[model samples]
Target: MKRLASVVALAVVVLFGTMAARALRIATPAATTGTAIAIPAIDTAAAALHLAAAVRFPTVSLASGGPIDTAAFLGLHQYLQAAFPRVHAALTREVVAGLSLVYTWKGSDSTLAPVVLMGHVDVVPIPEPNLRDWEHAPFSGDTAGGYVWGRGAIDDKSTVIAVLEAVEGLLRAGHTPKRTIYLTFGHDEEVGGRYGARVSSTSSWREGSSRHSSSTKGGSWGHA
Candidate 1:
């Protein structure tokens, strides 16, 4: 019986070892094709500063019955308008649910379906007890040692600011998409997106316009 158990264990190990080796053998793609467009140099200093400034807002989203910071959300809206003047000038802005924002950039061709870019600005709050665990103040928007520190720095604000920056830059360059573009910024995501994403979707449906696809805050692309 002892010899049989030893043989079974050895056989299991060899099978798993073979399986691991096979899994590790990933083949390179046969053919990859893409245009090599030169990426323009970004002003690192300005980019970092802007991200840091966005981090300063403590737009905490809480579950129903929990506290929500409306002031921070409003402040972020004001900051976005000031930062991306061209976006505000070109895109038609509307507030949904009193706090959520939607911006539509009209396209040259009405036949093409619009594209929606969705991002949330609200973040989960850092509990008072966990404050000591943070390297910097939760709302300080600290930029140090090649890092931006704050609550919404990575959760949702980064995507929100990035989309605005891209749109503003494109507008400045006089670049217009063939299809209409919609920018939707949700105010609540950390808890539940009921008042944010869900409302935006319902609003779009009511408008009788279909969106081809949506680029979500956390890098998800979905067909609508």
Candidate 2:
């Protein structure tokens, strides 16, 4: 009788374990459906050229906290003004912290919060030892081999140029948004965003308004 009782207990345990495993295996996943947004088209060749021009500037942020390339940064700013004439003319451009660039495109409605688009123009310095490893000069802004080769090509300049191109195109088309748009190009993001992005955020917050949303150049957007 004791042997029979032991056999029954083992059978019950097996049955419950199998039932639990089967239940877990058949469980449904959470829903992930969402709406899709349609982004407007931009000028590919012109945007590429602008990005290439941006890359030529060696706005390198030294890790050891050395002097920044102020001349190159000013040159890049001049280039941006030349490339996006409509944006510079239409938007309210301001140089925050003497290095960062901020452009505000005033919208039709003042009640709505402004949207901020951010990107870094600063890039890591290329060491002399790794210079030979590069197929082309790191600061050449070479658009050869069907790719933009430079230090800030992908790290940030591409994004800043893309945003400028989009805004410039919109300005050309005379499209005005309901909410204001803010373009922030930080100059010292490689070391830390302290002097550039931090100052902008603090200043804006002091004005009793914050960003509604933020879109970074690396294709990330989030609500504030």
- Which has the greatest TM-score? 1
**Sequence-dependent TM-score of model 1:** 0.78
| CA lDDT, candidate 1, residue 24 | 83
User: TM-score for all predictions?
Assistant: 0.78, 0.78
- Per model, state how many residue pairs clash: 0, 0
Q: For candidate 2, write residues 47-142 as lDDT tens digits.
A: 888888899999987654577779999999999999999999998888877788888888788886778788889999888899999988999999
In model 1, where do residues sit more than 4 Å from their true spots?
Answer: 1-41, 201-210, 215-217
Report the error of model 1 at residue 34, Å: 12
Task: Report how far off residue 215 is in candidate 2 (Å).
Answer: 5.3
Candidate 2 TM-score, C-alpha based: 0.78
lDDT of 1 by residue, 166-191 (tens): 78777877777766888888887776
Q: Which ten residues in a row have the lowest lDDT in candidate 1?
A: 32-41
